[model samples]
Target chain A: MKNNTTLLRVITYVVLISTTSILINDIQEFNFEQFKSFASWSKSVNKNENWFTSKNAIMWSYYIIITALFFWRGYLIYGFTHFVSILKEIEKENYFSQKNINYFKKIGNVFITYTINVLVLQFLLSVIQGASFNFFKELKNEFTFLIPCGLAFYLLAEIFKRAKTLKEENDLTI
Target chain B: MPITVNLDVMLIKRKMKSKELAQKIGITTANLSILKSGKAKAIRFSTLEAICEALECQPSDILEYKP
Candidate 1:
């Protein structure tokens, strides 16, 4: 158990660190310069001042949608932290504790939420930028695997709940 | 929940303390308390056999099915 827990902890740490650093790298690479076009358009439209007629609305929307995507990536990373909490419960011999069950459900919620929101935002951004958005191609991305994994975590939580009741009954049985 | 344990009655008849019975049967006092208090869901055959041996009573004496 110790060996397995240690190995799992290491793997989780590596995943969290790599993901977070990758996100930070993307944020650094994000171009505020893209919004520069919106600036000249902003001045040009000052007489009319209608955002709809602004020449750079698409670029602005693209930046906004991409930034939202980055935040959702951060949200997904937050979900991964719950795995550490679940591992902590296991460390204390509380494999079926309510806290662990809640953590599992929470992770499932986060994974599904992040995936669905990211997909929607990506689609919307593509529509704004006049890019072709392929649903199956997006599904083939590595992150899409989290959907099944999220469902699996919810299943684990339900199974743990049943096991907890059985364990309590067994403990009281003499 | 309908099935109740009458371990306390058997313990009294056998003139044995709960702690003593728990010791003889190789179970903790807390668990024996759970059984005596009718909080236990089920009893294992090995534990039931040990309890019967310790109390010199039948399983029916220590367990009752009340409607």
Candidate 2:
């Protein structure tokens, strides 16, 4: 299990590095023509007409990145807090204290929040990519894809809520 | 769910105050209170052993089966 975890960590870093490299490449190759096409496409949609402009698109990307980073940090904070608590509980040899159960709930909450943020970003990226290429035919496809993401978010929230309730009961008993 | 704790009886027999027992056992009064009130979900064997040694009693003196 330890070896598998290390391998997973390595794979995650590799993926992150590759993704950052690709994003840098895309930013370097960015051109005014793409912006013009995107702006024109935005004008077609009443909801995001202003967002199609070059400046607005850049601002939108920044906003998305900021929101994503904030939530990502929140997820990390909750994850680390829960992890430390679990370690402390284990150190105290209090397995029946249900502290780890509370930590599991925290992990679930973080996972759900992070998953929702990623899903929203993916939806926005799909819409932006389709609009830039004038792919109106695939517009409905993006909205439909969000349904499962929403369901998964709801399921995770419910699971965490149940776990939290159990933890509370355990705490009360103690 | 209906387990019984005889912490109070043992403390009384030893003529030891809860606060003093807590201090001697390196645990907080709050935790000692929880144990005395039979609300503790679990207790570490080491903690149980320490309490028994400090009070010079057996586990049966501090814990009992009620259900």
Please report the candidate that would top TM-score against the real structure. Answer: 1
Model 1 / residue A34 / CA error / Å: 1.0
- Model 1 Cα lDDT, one tens digit per residue, A1-174: 988998999999999999899988988987868668667766766575555645456667777887798778889899989989988888888988999989999999998888899889999988987899999999999889999999999999899999999888777666
What does candidate 1's lDDT look like per residue over B1-67, in tens digits?
A: 6788888778778888999998999989898888888877778999999988988889999888888
- Docking class of predicted structure 1: medium
Query: Which docking class does model 2 fall in?
Result: incorrect
lDDT of 2 at A85: 59
- Model 2, A1-174: lDDT tens digits are 456545655665665566456555655764546456556756765773554678667656845654464345444444435545554565565543545655655665555565556556655665655544323444355334444554554565466567666775666442
> Cα RMSD to native, each candidate?
2.4, 10.0
User: Per-residue lDDT for A35 in model 2?
Assistant: 53
Q: Which ten residues in a row have the lowest lDDT in candidate 1 chain A?
A: A48-57
True contacts kept of each: 0.95, 0.25
Clashes of 2: 0
**lDDT (Cα atoms) of all candidates against the true structure:** 0.86, 0.63
TM-score of each: 0.89, 0.41
Leading candidate by DockQ: 1
In model 1, residue pairs whose N, Cα or C atoms come closer than 3 Å (at least 3 residues apart or on different chains), thus clashing, are: none
